[model samples]
Target: MALLTVKNLKKNYDGSPVIRGIDFSINKGTCVALLGPNGAGKTTTLRMLSGLIRSNGGSISFEGLDYQTDIRYHIGYLPQHPVFHSWMSGKEFLVYVARLANLDKKTAASRADELLARVGIADAKNKRIGKYSGGMKQRLGIAQAMIHQPKLLMLDEPVSALDPIGRREVLTLMEELKQETTLLFSTHILNDAEEVSDELLMMHNGEIVESGPMEKVREKHRVDKINVVLQEGFIPDEDLITALPSVIRTEVARGVHHIFVTDTKQARDELLQLIQAERWPLERFEVGRASLEDLFMKVVDS
Candidate 1:
């Protein structure tokens, strides 16, 4: 079931449209990634959904909530650049946020401890926010967002600023969190989305260009292509590969040949026959579908 729905969503600044009319829904208990390059209005969309900013035009519907109601009560948002009270400890900050969310003192303290433990930063709960590492601080930010046990959790570029280790830490946390709550995160990093998300919302210039389950979207854009890697210092003959009856085009980059074809079986049979006849120094050969990056480029460029 859809936990949240949007229709004709739009936003503008000084009459310049940043988010054009776009529509999508978030289903219950699924990890959805909002993907686009910078200036794609991803941040604007998230801000509007979180009720931090009002939209110029559109309607948002959350399950069990009436239209025009404050949906912020059901949403937990962690911005790209979250500010922390440097002097406060992790536990203290969370308790403070819980209190702000309208929890009583005792309940806020209990919830704060529970969340700090949940996000794997319990060991640093008493430590000052100023002393926390990037990863720990991020985990703390997540804990604060969950203080009220929101039905949906939204993160903006959760790992974009972290080091490799920090990125890995947060990504691992996200993988675990998806099992418990619906997740909506925005990212420009394709690999991270591919690794963790079940659904994708590919936006460009304030519109959703592609949106669906990851596998469905990939299959929709799949192409009949073959990749060949010759042994070191040996280059595949592009002219020879392109001459095959089934082959449409061939591109070589760093000794790897990408051959696009009209017929996969015919292309593979013909290529193998030529490789055997010419005794080509083949290191690897595989037939595959187009990658997520390739699909993103194809849609954006089109």
Candidate 2:
């Protein structure tokens, strides 16, 4: 079942529309990625859903509760650049957040301890926030977001600010968190989204241009292309390859030839036959599946 539903969601800034009547839903126990380039209004949409900003039009329903209701109670939001109280210890910060969530003092302390361990930062719980590394701070931020046991967790560009090690650490934590909550994280990093999400909402120009299961979306937008690589000092005749009946066009970049084709099977056969007849020096030939980057470029350009 859908844990959250958004219909005709719209947002405007000073007479300009930012979110233009976008619609989507999040199913329970699924990790959905909101993907787009920078300036795609990803942050704006998340803020609206988190109740940090009001939509100019449309409705947001969480578990059937209307937008007029205080749905923030059911949402845990971590902004891209989350501010931490550097003076406070990790455990102290969580306890303070938990208390704000209305947990009793004893429960707040207990919950803080539990979450610190859950996020794999129990050893650093007593350490000052200023002393924690980027990854540790992100983990702590996630823990704070979950303090109230929210049904939906929204992370805005969660790993965008981290180093390689920090990014991996937070990503691993996200993978684990998926088992426990319905996660909706926004990011422009296609690989990260592909790594952790089951569903995708591809936004562009403040609108959701495409959304569905990751595989399904890719299949629907699949491009017909073959990648060919030749050994050093060997180059295939581009005109010869493009003249094939099944081939449409060819492009070469960094010693790799990208052959766009009409039919993969026919193109493979024709290219192989030609290569054999002419004794062309071919190192590798691959039938390429459309990658997320490919799909993103196609959709955004369209």
Model 2 Cα lDDT, one tens digit per residue, 144-171: 9999889999999999999998899889
TM-score of 2: 0.90
Tell me the TM-score of each prediction against the true structure.
0.92, 0.90
* lDDT, candidate 1, at 251: 81
* Candidate 2 wrongly placed segments (more than 4 Å): 64-69, 237-243, 272-282
* Count of clashing residue pairs in every prediction: 0, 0
Error of 2 at 151 (Å): 1.5
For all predictions, the C-alpha RMSD in Å is 2.1, 2.4
lDDT of 1 by residue, 209-284 (tens): 9999999999888888999988898765678888899999988888788889998889999999999988998889
Off by over 4 Å in 1: 235-243, 273-279
Task: Go through the candidates in order and give each one's C-alpha lDDT.
Answer: 0.92, 0.92
Reference-based TM-score, model 1: 0.92
RMSD of 1: 2.1
